[model samples]
Target: MELAKEIAKGAEEEGAEVRIKRVRETLPQELQSRIPLDKVEDIPEVTLEDMKWADGFAIGSPTRYGNIAGALKTFLDTTAVLWKDNLLYGKPVTFFTEASTIHGGHETTILTMSTYAYHFGMVIVPVGYGIPELFQTTTGGGPYGATHLGSKEELDEMERKIARFQGKRIAEVAKKLKS
Candidate 1:
């Protein structure tokens, strides 16, 4: 959630309209309430209509056993209709992931999620080397996408800058493609 917020903030900072929302959780009812939804303020539940409204997107998730969290994957699975219709084709999209450890499979998570964008025919926007912060970070944020390797409650300065840069880059690409 912190990743998404900062990404959206960065996109808006670059004059792009941004919406921060989450896909419906597929967690079992027994474990659903355990998630502190209020912790990630300002993110609304994402809907298919919302997906259709975006010019670009930054889909993020916490890493789970070297892959995306099940809930997010489940949500992505629900987009088959859009995939079939090619609703997201030509739009720009990027990915981000968070993990508990410094090497906690973040890069793989980003790669796996990129497949979804590929199936949607979306233009991929990588963070690349445009941001000097990427080279200076001891933790998350990479070419695959913006990343986080520590507490979700807070971010290191480097990670924050990378998130901002990734968001800005995504917006810039989306604007170019849109025009």
Candidate 2:
């Protein structure tokens, strides 16, 4: 959700109202090293409900073994009920991912996340325009979306810009779709 937070912050700056929330996921012990324990536990039931209510969404997760973390996957798997009702249809959605090592299956993780959006009939928004920082910056983000550089401290100014840009882009798309 870091990317979403960036977007939301940017949207706010642009005089766009934005609401951002996180969905809680259940995870096995093996995955604990990959995600913050507090984040995993503090998730609330309202997150999913909020997802249904939002005009658009930016979903993010850490990559694991060339795919999205099991925790995030588990949370998404629960959305089958939402899918059955076709509630997510027409929503503008985008995804972002982080990984421990460079080349750690970032694309695979994004693809896996994208699959859920596809099933929900949501429009997948790409980061179309290339941000200069993506190729020049030392830390996170690329054409995919805002991403972390595997460590907390690695998230620098460039990452922040990319995150905000991604969020603003999604919000813009959501606004367009809504209109």
The TM-scores, one per candidate, come to: 0.93, 0.84
Candidate 1 Cα RMSD (Å): 1.6
Give the Å error, residue 11, model 2. Answer: 3.2
Q: Once superposed on the true structure, which residue ranges of model 2 sit more than 4 Å away at CA?
A: 1-4, 29-35, 39-46
The per-candidate count of clashes, in order, stands at 0, 1
Q: How close is candidate 2 to the true structure, as a TM-score?
A: 0.84
- Which RMSD values do the candidates have, in order? 1.6, 2.6
Over 1-179, each residue of candidate 2 has an lDDT whose tens digit, in order, gives: 45556767866765566665555556666865755667434444445687778888888877778788776777788888889999899899877877777677777788888988888999998775556777776557667667776756456788788888777778788889899
Candidate 2 backbone overlaps, count: 1
lDDT of 1 at 48: 89
TM-score of model 1 vs. true structure: 0.93
